[model samples]
Target: MIGLVLAAGAGRRLRPHTDTLPKALVPVDGDLSVLDLTLRNFSEIGLTEAAVVVGYRKEAVYARKDELQAAYGLKLTLIDNDRAEEWNNAYSLWCARDVLKQGAVLANGDTVHPVSVERTLLDSRGGGRRIILALDTAKRLADEEMKVIAADGRGVRQITKLMDPAAATGEYIGVTLIEPEAAEALADALKATFERDPDLYYEDGYQELVDRGFRIDVAPIGDVPWVEIDNHDDLARGREIACLY
Candidate 1:
């Protein structure tokens, strides 16, 4: 299995810092960047190889690839998303489809969380579940959060940022375990999603899979503090929680 990171977005909300570096390279704690923490988490979880999808000032990542590899003791593969500045992450994730044959544990590069999040997805991977999403059922939902809804006693029914907060059971924490059995189907779904609308998110791909009768269940991260760094405020929150890891 491999570790995958979606680090392509421009993150315009984070200026100055993002002007020269990708959001993944933005420092959240001291001199350690978001990508640093992600690679560390993957290393701790026994993922020796990780594929990072890069775009938007990707040279920064290329420059530090060797240094990062040496620090984490993990092999790194850089996947370029040429359309990252024009499209959403569905296309970015689809670019790494060919490498996920052995199954993959994928996470957003901008999200700051403890290594426990990765451990939870890894520990819950059996029982024939092809895909398991790390969900934060304890977080209070807002309109911007990527929300999820369960089906009639089944797995995920839908995942979207447009869903009503009251109807959402939880926020999909941007971490997922994808068994090899579901990689191809997920790739196809991501393809269809991007072809339909380049602006759609990778979560839309999960919704497509759910609509196709695939079981994408959730692993609840109970009371585990995590923050998706999107702006100045989120960066502050990330700094506060990152030390706990």
Candidate 2:
């Protein structure tokens, strides 16, 4: 039951700031970076072993690994994603494939969500195929966010990333509670997507598995404190969320 933090994105939208530091190292509310906050939140839920995948400005992510290890008694592992500049979050997951076991919680390096995210994953009992955090995109309709089209009746059917605005349904909050077998299945598809088009995102893997009839449980974090810090606006949003700091 280890936690994996996917932080290998180039974060081009973050520009000069990202040029100097990884998004996980980006300061959230002075003295605390988003990565630190995320780990602290993990600690609250009793997750002390967190593996962070680093890419853009990888050194910055490594610098925190030691601090996090000493300060929290958490064993932080930094996996250098050599191809991070050429791949997507899915690729980052692929790099950590050797580490993630069954019943693991995976979050993005830039995701700043409530402490409850940890509780949600830990307490779920792993009864379903995959449990993921969903959010209402109705409020903020048009970001390049991964949106899911979830069908309410019978069971949940999620269609993620509608290129057309009218087709998108809900937003994916980048928090995942996954079964190792399912992850391996998804990773296989992801490898194909990356091999064909290395630049494509990991969501493409979901599209493949969903086509094969995999049903993922939707844990809607509707109106809860969650922010994916891809740019300046998100950083501001992170600042606004009630921090445990």
Q: How well is each residue in 149-220 modelled by candidate 1, as lDDT tens digits?
A: 976448898899998899998999999999998989999999999999999999999999999998999988
Where is the poorest 10-residue window by lDDT in model 2?
153-162
Q: What is candidate 2's lDDT per residue for 1-245, written digit by digit as tens?
A: 67778887767788777788877877777767777777877777787688888888887777667788777667888888889887776677778776665456788888888877667655654555464544555446575778777666422455556555566666777777776666667677667767777777667766666777776665655567677888888888887873644
Judging by lDDT against the true structure, name the best candidate. Answer: 1
User: How accurate locally, in lDDT, is each candidate?
Assistant: 0.91, 0.71
Q: Candidate 1 has which clashing residue pairs, if any?
A: none
Cα deviation of 38 in candidate 2 (Å)? Answer: 1.2
lDDT of 2: 0.71
Count clashing residue pairs per candidate.
0, 0
